[model samples]
Target: MVVKMNLKHVDELSGGRKRFRRRYPKSLVPVLGEAVFQVAMKAREGGALVSEWESLMKTYDRNVAKAERAAGVAGADDRLSPLELWREARRDAAAMLAAFKDDLTEDERRELLGDELERREADPVLYRAVVEPDAPEPKPTLLDAKNMYLQERLEGGTGRNNKNRLDRVCKRIEATLGPLNKLSLVDLTRDQARTLRDAMLSTRKADGTRLAPASVRRELDMIKAMVSLGIKEFGLQREADNPFIDLPISSKGVAPDVDSSKRDPLPKNVLLAMRDRMREKAQVPALGLIWRLLEGTGCRGAEVVGLRREDVVLDGLYPHINVAWHEDRRVKTKASIRSVPLVGDALVAAREALTLSEGEPMLFPKYARENGPDAASAALMKHLRTVTKNPRHVVYSLRHNMKDWLVLAGTSERVENRIMGHTVGGLGDRVYGGNDAKLKVAYEAMEKAIKGMP
Candidate 1:
C-alpha cells in the first residue's frame, strides 16, 4: 500500500529541516550528511519522489503493525519490539523493491531539470529583448569628447594660458555687469548696445565721478567679443542673427586712449620735469634709467616688466632688444613681436639698466613676497605720477607719448598699428596675415621717430 502526497512548490526550501506535501513519521534509515534531512522535502516537492516517499512510509507502518501483533501473541522473535521491527523493515528486501519501482515510474517524473538547463542557455538574449526592446542605444555624451578635442589646441601651455585668461574675462563680465546689462547682452542688438552705452555713461566710478564715455566704449568692445564667441565658437546663436554685427557704438568719449596724446601723453614740459625729478629722487641710478627707457621706448607696461637681460641682442648690425619672448610678455600681435631699434635716450637707458643685472630678470628684480610682477610696474607708474602731477598719466603714457610723437611726426596708421601690435580689417585679417613684414617696417618707423625726437 502507498500513501498519497500532494504537489509542493520550490520556494519552500530553507534552513536544515525539510517539509513535504506528504505526511510521514521520521525515516528509520540513518541520516548521512545535512542534505539527508531535506530528502523528505525534496521527495514531496518532486512528483516522482513524493510517490516513493509515500510508499516507503506505508511499508514501514505495515511492518511495525505486523511486529506489534506478533509480539502480543508471543510468536517467534517476540524479543523484537515494534520500534526494532520498524528499523529492521527499512533494510527489508520487500521495501527496497517498492522504492526501486517508484523511482522508475514513467508517469510521475518530468524532464523539468532539462527544461531549466535550456532556459538558462537562452536567458541572455531573452533578457536583453525585455529590457531594451527598440532601436539601438545612444552613446555617452560628447562633453568629455569635446574637452579631449580642445585639450590639444586650447588647454595647455601658451594656448591654455590664453584660454584661461579669456575665462577670467568672462568671470569679470559676469561679476561687473548688472540686470540692465542683460537687456543689452541677451539679444546682442544695436538698440541694446546703444542703451548699454547710455546706461554705462550714466553710471559713476567708486568716487562718484560720472564714468567716461571711452570707458563705456571699451567695456562694450569686451561685450562684443563675448557675444561673438557665443555665436562663432559655442554655437549659442546663428551668425546671421548675431546682434553685434552692425551695432552703432559711440566711439566718442573713452578714457586712457593710447591715441589721445593731449590726454595721455606726458607734455614735453611734464616729461622733462619727471626725468629731472627721477634722476634726483630715485633710490638708484638704475631706477632713473628705467624711467628714461619708458619715456624713450614706448614699450608696453607688460613688455617692460617682462624684459629679461638676455633679450638684449646688443651685437647686431642694428642693435635692438627682442621684446617678443620676454618671460611675462604678451605681444598684442605677431607684428608687435618684431624688433625695434634702440637709439638716443632709450638706448642709453636700456644699456644702463642691462649693466645693473648680472644675467637675471629686469633691471629691478621683483621684490620677495610679491604675488606677481605688477608691483614693480605700479611703483614705476606711481613715481612718475608723483613727479608729473598727472597721476592719471601713468607709465603707459610712455607708449602713448611715443605714439603721439609718431603721429605728430606724420607716422602712418599702419605703422602706428604695427608698433602697437594692432591689426586692421578685423578677424579675417588677424588669421591670414599673422606676421606682416610691412607692418614691421612701420613699427621701425615709430622707433626712428623716437630717435629723431628732440
Candidate 2:
C-alpha cells in the first residue's frame, strides 16, 4: 500500500516521483519572469522526500523574498496600479488567445480559456480588473515633471548648474509637501506654494542664519519653471492657475545688491601684497597665473580657471585669452564669449602657464574638470585668507578691483563692459564692432588699468 504524505506545494508524481511547485504572486510575475516555479525531486522515501521538500521550500522562500524586495525597489507597485495591471493583463490575455487560436483547434482554445475564466471568476477583483476598460493614464506628479524637465533640458549638454538647482528645489518642496511622486501636478495649489515659500524662509542654515532671500527667490523661480514646463509638455489642463507663477516673495530687509554688498574690492596695498606673495618661487605656478589672469583681465574666476591650451593666444597681435564656451566648460553668458586682451602681469603669467601646460588640453589641468572652477576658487580663497583677514576681501574682489582701476583710468563704459564681459544692453552696443575693433579698445583700456594699478 502507498502512504500518501500531504505536503504543501509538493505533488506526488508517477513512479513515486515528487515535484515541488509554487506560483509567484501576480504582482511579482513581471519581475520574476514567470507565473510558476517547478523543480523535480529525486528523493523517494517518505522521510527523505519530506527533508528535500523542506530544503526546497526554504530556497523558494528566499528567492521570493529577494524578488519582492527588488520589486519594491523598482517601484513596481507604484507603476503597476490596478488599472495598469488590468490593461496589461487584458493585452496579454488577448495575445495568448490569438496565438493559441492560430496553433490549436477550437476545442483546445476553448479549454484553455475556460480554465482562465474559472480562475477569474474565483477572484471578483481579478475578473473586474481584466474586464475593466477606459481607465485614464496615471496623472503625472512633481517627481515625474522634474525627471522629464531634466531629460529635455540637460540633453543640450549645458544646465548642470540648473540641474543641481532644480534638485535642491525639489528636495525642499518634497520636505514640505511629502513625496514629490505622490503630489500630482493638477492638485498643486497656491496655498501649498505659499506654505513652501514660508517654510523655506523660516529654514535656517548650518551657521544658524535664515536662508538668504536671493537664494529663496532662486528656489521659487526654479519650481515655477519646472511646473510651467510640465504643464506645457504634458498638456495638462487645470481648473486653477499655476500656483508657482507670480508668487509674491517679500524682499523686505534684503538689500537690492546683497551679493555686491557682501564683497568689497581689495585695497591697492592688499592687491600689491597678494601679488608679491604669488611671485614667490615656492608658490603654485598655475594658481599664481590664475590670480594674475583674474587681476589683469578682470575675467570671472571660472573663465580664467577653465581656459584650454588653445584659448591662450601668445603669438597674436594682441596676446589675449579667448573666454568662449568649450565642450569641457561653459561660459557664463553670451557676452562672456569675447576675447580678453592680456596686458601687464597677465601677459607674463599666460606665457609661463602655456609652457607649464606641456601641450595638455587644459591650461590648468588640475582645475578643468567638473566643479573645477569652484575648486580653483576655494584654493585661491585659502591663499587669499593668508594675506588678509578681512571677511569681505575674497578672490573675486580682484574683479571689483580691476573694475575700479578701469574706471579710474578713464576707460569708456563700452570698453569696460567688453573687457569685463558685462552685458551690453542696447543693440548699438552689441552690433557696433567686429573682433579686432573690440580687442583694440579692450587692450588699450586694460593697459591703462594695469598702469594705474597701485
Best by TM-score: 2
In model 1, the clashing pairs are 213-253, 214-253, 214-254
Worst 10 residues of 2 by lDDT: 122-131
By summed lDDT, which 10 consecutive residues of candidate 1 come out lowest?
138-147
lDDT of 1 at 73: 32
Model 2: per-residue lDDT, tens digit, 341-403? Answer: 998888998989989887577788777544567777888888788889999999988888888
**Across residues 1-454, which tens digit of lDDT does each residue of candidate 1 receive?**
1112222322234443235433222332222111222334344222244344444444444544443443343442333332233334333423323444345542222233224425765322223333333424222111212222234333222212444544543434344343222322234455545555566667766889775656555555655555554344434443324444545545455545444533576777778777778887877565576667666667765565456676776674455666775323445556567555566777777887777765555444542111123555666666776766764577777777777788887887765665565555566544555443553565467555875455
Candidate 1 residue 43 C-alpha distance from true site, Å:
75
- TM-score of each predicted structure versus truth: 0.48, 0.71
What are the lDDT scores of the predictions, listed in order?
Answer: 0.50, 0.75
